[model samples]
Target: MTELQRKLYRQAFALALITIFYNIAEGMISTYMGFQDETIALFGFGIDSVIETISGIGVAHMILRIQQNPNTPRDAFEIKALKITGFSFYILTAGLVVTSVYNLYSGQKPETTFWGLVIASISIFTMWALIWAKMRVGRALDSKPIIADAGCTRVCLYMSVILLISSLTYEITGLPYIDAVGALALAWFALKEGRECFEKAKSISVCGCSDGCH
Candidate 1:
């Protein structure tokens, strides 16, 4: 690796650490508020944040490994980690779908979603910045795992938007189903991300490359 690439790897590692910490805090707050308000969407979003933190830790470990031994080939451990992350996403998708359907069927309504709105709004900006940094570093280093991690962050951004819109719409109209709809949207987004992560993992296992790499 060149000096610049080394620098980028260091930056990516730092960013991964930041992602871990941020997601921990976000997940705790969101989950707490979710339970307090009985909001399925917010609760699911918090779980997703926790899962993303796992991915961030994996990415950080991979970056450190690569930095320590630049010539090391992608190994089974890394592939397994990616697969686990991908599988977790699929599980999240299924859970969200089931929960949303139940919420819709039961006509459940949140008691209050003020904190959901606040958290989602803050998440949007934070995730955007993280996505930008991760993409920049991933592209610079041509690291599939880092890029895939960034893609995960992008999904989080979409979830934040969904949460924000659903919370706001519910606050304004007092519609209960809209919150369920947002959870469905989150499920759809997570399904897409899960597929992408699995595909990337397959590609790396077979050819040691991500989709965009030649």
Candidate 2:
């Protein structure tokens, strides 16, 4: 391997680690704050972060495998991880849907969505930086896997935006249903991600998180 390729691989691996650790921390903090504040949207978002951590592990393994041999196929561990991630996403979707419905039926409102706003703003900035860096490294190595990882990060970026908008909207208008609405939106994304994970496990060319690399 050339020195440039080695350096690019190191960069890619580092990005994967960053993504994993960041999601862990984000999940912990968001879940804590969400529960404390009784915000359905924030809670669902946090849960999603934790599930993303699982997928991130599989991606990291994928990076290592492809680094060793670009032509190597997906291994058992990666497939298992993908299946686990898929089930987790589906479970989360069902959970969020039920919780959101209960909240709406109960006419419940969050004490504060202040923390959601804060965490989501941070996530947006962080995801954007990761996307840019991953794209740069992926292109440097001419790696489709790395580039596809970047596309998945783009989906996370979209979720962060949704959280930000929902939180901000609720704060501005003091609406009770907005949090539930936001959670339902997240559920939709989770459903999509779940289906895609299984598709990724079965298909060689699928990107894993979102439908396609693009």
Candidate 3:
């Protein structure tokens, strides 16, 4: 592999590992503190993080597959990974929409937590880094799966922004209901992105078509 390819793979691998750890931390926090807040937005955030972690795994798997077979046919494992990741995101988005609707109907209010805020802030920065790095690498290598993976991180970044806004709104208004609304909005965004990814994957016939290697 070229030096650029190796560098890109390493960066993606490292980001994937970081995403795994972040998912674990988020789940722990949700288990301990999520019940206190009725908002359900935090729960959605945690769920989304788990989805992102899985997507990261898909990306890592693709990179590893490529490494194992440097001369592997372009339409082999990489295309499979793209389809898998797209399907995974679609499911994740569906779940988020369901949870969001339920939260909105049930009038769930989320309590403001300092730790949650801190974690969200840290996640925002990490997501920005991941998205930027992935875009650079994906574009360089003409890798569709990697670019789709980067799209997942972009979704995460927007979700973080929604979470931040909702958290701040809760702190200011003490309405609590706004959190659920924020989550619904974020879920819509996820669904949109997820569908786009799915469409891209399904429409493409080959890994290195006009769009690029899958």
TM-scores for candidates 1 onward, in order: 0.90, 0.94, 0.77
For all candidates in order, the CA lDDT equals 0.84, 0.89, 0.68
Candidates 1 and 2 compared by lDDT, better number: 2
Best by TM-score: 2
- Per-residue alpha-carbon lDDT of candidate 3 for residues 1-214, written as tens digits (9 for 90 to 100): 7887788777767767777787767756753555565546676677666655555665666667666665554453445555665576677567667876776687655656454566678778988987888898778887776787787778788888887777777777877467767777767776776676566656655344533443
List runs of model 1 lying over 4 Å from the truth. 142-145, 208-214
Give the lowest summed-lDDT range of ten residues in model 3: 205-214
Write the residue-wise lDDT of candidate 1 on 118-202 in tens digits. 9999999999999999999988887776787788788789899999999999999999898889889888887887787788678
Ranking of all predicted structures according to lDDT, beginning with the best and ending with the worst: 2, 1, 3
lDDT of 1 at 77: 70
Considering every candidate listed, which one attains the maximal lDDT?
A: 2
Clashes of each: 0, 0, 5
Tell me the tens digit of each residue's lDDT in model 2 across 1-214: 7888888898899999999999999999999999999998999999999999998998899888877876667777878888999999999999999999999999899999999999999999999999999999988887777888898899999999999999999999998999999999999999999998888787744543321232
C-alpha lDDT of candidate 1 relative to the true structure? 0.84
